[model samples]
Target: MTAPQRARSAQPALDRVDRRILDHLADHGRSSIADLAEAVSISASSAQRRLRRLESEEVVRGYRAVLDPIAVDRGLVVHLAVTLVDHTTNTVGRFERHVLDLAGLVSCHHVTGDVDYLMRVDVADVEALDVLLRRTLARLPGVARLTTMVATSAVVDRVTQV
Candidate 1:
């Protein structure tokens, strides 16, 4: 099966109330149960119950502080189109495991395309990216080739809305 197809097939359906809770939570991750209840027009206990359900179901993965990358100095974003030396399962698994230990790896997707994987990397600058590509990614096992595209600007970066 295609990678996108697999992702689409795995999404669980959410009801109206569940969607409302998610929307509110997306806007305010640190919102109290009482506050969420008020926003969603439900009782505190009910909101708590639904929140628990969302967590258990993996609908709400985890809460995190979304900081400005530029402010922290890791502003440069690069999307790498990577081709593997082989299409073997072992090679793919090894590559995946190895990239996890890499410092600049933002996200990696095993994709169905000319390239075996697409990786998003964030670094402090072009020099840092050059070092990453040379010292880290290029030397990784099973990496046949890599094409890097620097993102000049992010037109849209958002969480999935309910």
Candidate 2:
């Protein structure tokens, strides 16, 4: 209905302390308040207050345990590059709605260049991936072409750092 209200600038004004807190939290999401305080060289109360502020500001967002793909029966990782038929808002919106609801989806980016979207998904195996491609991804709204690449192994798979 309406465009998102973006911040005044691209980057948030994070001081050294805030940076340290974020960096520490990025690596250790389940760390206690005392642990975080010690890591960032701040008092427990200060660390807590800052963490609360970060949460309220929607910077830290939420936390969850990172699961191993093989352990979870989702070891097959695939990247799907999508080329849309056109760049109409209606088409893109429809596509996004469908994509976000897809099972096994890790992430999706509305990217630039030759393709309209670049999406990463994890499935049980090749059969599951085939179904996702043929029955799901290929049938999305305004889809023109689909290019897929299955990851053999991850050389540098890690969570994003602050």
**Least accurate stretch of 10 residues (summed lDDT) in model 2?**
1-10
Compared with the true structure, all predictions reach lDDT values of 0.88, 0.88
For candidate 2, lDDT tens digit of each residue in 10-100? Answer: 3357889999999998888999999999999999999999999888887899997788777786889899899999999999999999999
The TM-scores of all predictions, comma-separated, are 0.82, 0.87
**Any idea what lDDT model 1 has?**
0.88
Clashing pairs in 1: none
Candidate 2 Cα RMSD (Å): 3.1
Report, for all candidates in order, the number of backbone clashes.
0, 0
